[model samples]
Target: MPIINLNGPKLSTAKKKELVKRFTEVASEVIELPEEAIIVEINEMPPENVGVGGELLSEKEDK
Candidate 1:
């Protein structure tokens, strides 16, 4: 089985479902594997758990 792990901020259930579906479809086509043979994992990270330039993501301003 092929595994795809994605780590990022938290997301909605709908978005997660969409991502899994899209990823499975594309991966299946490119790798010639069945959708069921591919595994997609999503790791949701809190802003405080992520950092940027020595600062926590929660403390950084969007510029």
Candidate 2:
């Protein structure tokens, strides 16, 4: 079994579903595993809890 974990900002349910589908296809092809044997987990984080270039995402967005 293959597990794929993705961490990013929150997204719509449709977007999440698309990601899972696309990721599964690519991962299955690359790893030579069946789609049924692959798992995709999406971890979403709030802007306050995520940072970039020494600034919090929320703070940067305020600029």
Candidate 3:
């Protein structure tokens, strides 16, 4: 089994589904694995819990 872990801000259900589909397709092609054998885990975090450039996402957005 191949596992692909993705961590980022929260996303809508449609977006998540799209990502999963695309990721599975690429993984299957690159790794020579079946789509059923590829696992994609999306870990969502709030803006407060995610940061960029030494600032929290939420804080940066306020600027």
Give the candidate number with the greatest TM-score.
2
Comparing 2 and 3 on lDDT, the stronger one: 2
| C-alpha TM-scores of all predictions | 0.89, 0.94, 0.91
Listed per candidate, the RMSD to the true structure in angstroms reads: 1.7, 0.7, 0.9
Residue 1 C-alpha lDDT in model 1 = 73
Give the lDDT ranking, best first. 2, 3, 1
List candidate 1 segments past 4 Å from native: 61-63
Give the per-residue Cα lDDT of candidate 2 at 33.
Answer: 88
Better of 2 and 3 by TM-score: 2
Model 2 Cα shift for residue 57 (angstroms)? 0.5
> What TM-score does candidate 3 reach?
0.91
**Higher TM-score: candidate 1 or 2?**
2
* Model 2 Cα lDDT, one tens digit per residue, 2-62: 9999999999999999999999999999999899999999999999999899999999989
Give the count of colliding residue pairs in each prediction.
Answer: 0, 0, 0
Model 1 accuracy (lDDT, Cα):
0.92
